[model samples]
Target: MTLRLAFMGTPDFAARSLAEIAAAGHEVVHVFTQPPRRRGRGQSEQKTPVHQLAEVLGIPVSTPASFRDPDVIAHFASLDLDLAAVVAYGQILPQAALYAPRMGCLNLHASLLPRWRGAAPIQRAIMAGDTMTGVQLQQMEAGLDTGPILLSETVRIKDSDTAASLHDRLMEAGALMWPRALAALERGSLEAVSQSSDGVTYARKISSDEARIDWSRSAEELSNHVRGLSPFPGAWFEMPGEKRPVRVKVLLAEPVSGEAAAGPGTVIEGLTVACGEGALRLVRLQREGKGAMDAATFLNGNSLPAGTVLD
Candidate 1:
């Protein structure tokens, strides 16, 4: 039997779970998403991914600015929802809203829990050189991702994984958990397990300045840092040019064992820069205002010969 549910989410990551819920034959009573905001180069008002999907699905959508309003909380409670499924919903649900559903709110958090608990778990996990990370289905509480885990699926962090690659992988992994969780919930078989107090780490939001490449760090650490912020707010470094310093983003790289007389940010050979400890072979790069290209393709048009110093 299907449960009467309300879905709350934002962004593409959250949209996947919403689709799965509808596909699972649950009666989605409503959808709550963040309000539209101006974004992009033109700064035009754009609806969130969840908001757009709910429209196409023919489900009623609510874009409440805040759940703090008495009317907002009352409206949600009025849904008479058996349960509410939340994923990557930006806002914090108030205590009243948390208990509005019959079974309270169940969230799909993109982390193993108690570890990497905060705004940017996916990025932070890769940045911190973590060898593992996963998505957990948590029972929502008033605290920030402090809820007990009802279910979890682990995904390995490959050396080649960037935030973008790992994000898609985790999303696919998370989609499978939703059906299993909801079905178990309907069967009265789901269980919640509290997170361990140890190994707790906060994944604070990524800042603009933090994305700048620091060449002085070890090659291995620098590779992780570049992968963590890749493809968006990309890890960038400046290259010395005749006219001015040209900014280049390292989209992909690998830490290699080697030694060079040159210091960090110097091109030792073939797009490989000597780090404070080893060397990094930049596999992919993008110059400002140019499309991303492999190091070979980038070298064909531009020049970053050996002995060249990068800022």
Candidate 2:
């Protein structure tokens, strides 16, 4: 039986789940997305990934700023949805909207619930050097990610995984899991379990201030920092330039042992910088006004000789 579904989400990660849920033969009657915002170099207004897909699927879409509006809540209730699935929707649903659907709301969160309960879970996990993380489908409630679990799938955090890579992995997991859970819901066999209270930790948002790389840290820590923030709000250090200091983002890096002979932040070898305890070699870097490049290509264009210090 095709359940009357409504999907709420913003990012492409959510977009994939919405696609799969629809493909599973659910009647995705409507979609709720955040409004289009200016993005990219041109700053052109762009619709959210979910909204774009909903349009492609010929489903009606709504971009409500908030559910505080009584009309917004009533409009959702009018849909008479069997269930509403949320994935990185970026906004918290109030109780009025939470129970608007006949079966209430379900969320696919990136991290294991109660562990990384707040925003930026994927980034925080990598930055904290966590070895495992996964997608959790939970019952939506008034509190933050405090919901009970309906289903979950775990994946190992690889040494080379960045937030971008982990995000894609979790999205795929959600795409598969959402349909499975929906199938169970269709049969009334799905069960909800309370999340364990022992390991609660919040994954706060990544700040712009946290982007600057600190060379005084150990190479291993610096490596995690780099990978954690890679591809967005990247971990950066300032390079000495002829005119002034230049900011460069380290998109990929690995810790190397006993390599640097200089003080922390000093270049001891080609793209290898000294840290407090070890050395980190820059793998991929991006300079302002230029595209991302390998350490070799970046070195070929500019010079960072031995004994030069980066801040």
lDDT scores in order: 0.91, 0.92
Clashes counted in candidate 1 amount to: 0
lDDT of 1 by residue, 259-281 (tens): 75789889988899988989899
**Residue pairs clashing, model 2:** none
RMSD of each: 1.6, 1.2
Q: How accurate is candidate 2 locally (lDDT)?
A: 0.92
Where is the poorest 10-residue window by lDDT in model 1?
Answer: 256-265
lDDT of 2 by residue, 249-289 (tens): 99999999874678999998899999988999999999988
Runs of candidate 2 with Cα error greater than 4 angstroms are none
